[model samples]
Target: MSLPDPPAPIVHPAEYAFGDQVASAEEHLVGQVDQLLRTRFGKPVEAHLAAPTATDFAALRRWYGERAKGWQPLPDVEGAAKAGRGQGFGFSHGDQAFVMVWLTRDAAEGANPVTILRYGKAG
Candidate 1:
């Protein structure tokens, strides 16, 4: 699904687990998230298939997560699991997207999990 030129705010910050992606509870708007618009879909939401493949993850990291405009990080920021870092791919269903992500059961209080995509060295 295509997001707005400036993606709408965390209207629904609640994410659920599927295989395609991971999310953190503490959500914040990372710079450049607006630039990255389109990400490939592994299977349609209707299919309810397994998560993305390793190859897909690599591409997303290289493109959606690190290289391209990069991942926006979440379905619902408020609902994410607490504190830590993880990675994954984008899985879009209509207006919603559930990305691939690695998750640890728990983390430090207020730590707030989030994904860190690649960035160019500051000039």
Candidate 2:
């Protein structure tokens, strides 16, 4: 059977933090994350599947815990999951910041998804 068409790209409004700015600001952040992934990993990421469950977050925390200390979960923002797609990927930018993204499950399995992006101090 043919696969369903992927959902249209949705950047959850609540998660985006550009106050009174145009949508392009959020788009720009996504673009920066994309660029960082491509340059650092030497490949393109296609989607970021959502992980909205405690189990999902726990697994992610475990993984991060392996690499560093003081790892903390980002708060769940409205619409961040985007149809229940979960947070799937993350990286650190030097010693200053950590970035995470959520992806659709299909995208997580088949490709890359940079759906939800959040960054905070690296610890």
Candidate 3:
């Protein structure tokens, strides 16, 4: 007997939206993300001049987390918005997770863009 085919990927709407935004925002966004996005995801990334709104950033973060190979919990934010600070998810692309990072329109500034994030491989 013949074997069955593999299942298709579950591409969520939010994931697609984020990809579109990233693509529209930059031509080599993937390269840029691969270079620096890693640092922002799990740390307090510095704010930029043209950073996106906190909500948008959080949305994108969630999307990233969904595809994460591994995720970790973080402390709760004492004052700032829940999305802005506190625990975050982590994932590994290959051998290393690098440094999960995210940038807003105002990331150039000294604003804390990074959060309590974690990354690794899932069992």
Candidate 4:
């Protein structure tokens, strides 16, 4: 006899922002990221925990900095950069556009610790 099929994983909505708050569970965050990638590039892109260099970090900083005022306070670019170290993902869809994501862990008790460092797009 075959075992029962496993239950589907639960995916919670993620709030993309820059801060020390727990954005969502790791699994949820991964799902959101994958969905975004698939929507933009027609395929899922995995995020890497590799640290970003100063230059690489700066590019993301600049991109987010330019549009920060319109959204939220110029997110702690330096902090995000530091947190993003070894925890960021970058993807491109030809010349159409590109997306970068940086994540930070929340230290709160029972917190998901998968907050988004930054989520921005560039062309």
lDDT of each: 0.30, 0.38, 0.32, 0.34
Q: Which window of ten consecutive residues has the lowest lDDT sum in model 2? A: 1-10
Q: Of 1 and 3, which scores higher on lDDT?
A: 3
- Order the numbered candidates by lDDT, best leading: 2, 4, 3, 1
lDDT of 1 by residue, 61-121 (tens): 3444332233354443223322223333442333445443333333332122233322222
Root-mean-square deviation of candidate 1: 14.3
Better of 1 and 3 by TM-score: 3
What tens digits encode model 3's per-residue C-alpha lDDT throughout 30-55?
Answer: 23343343443433222112223433
lDDT of 4 by residue, 1-123 (tens): 111111112122254333333334344455544454454345432332322222244454455445433333322323333443423333232422233444443333222222232232322
The digit string of per-residue lDDT tens for model 2 on 4-60 reads 112323332334332333234344445555454444334332323323222244455
Q: Report lDDT (Cα) of residue 43, candidate 4.
A: 42
Top candidate, metric lDDT? 2
What is the number of residue pairs that collide in model 2? 15
State the local distance difference test value for candidate 3.
0.32
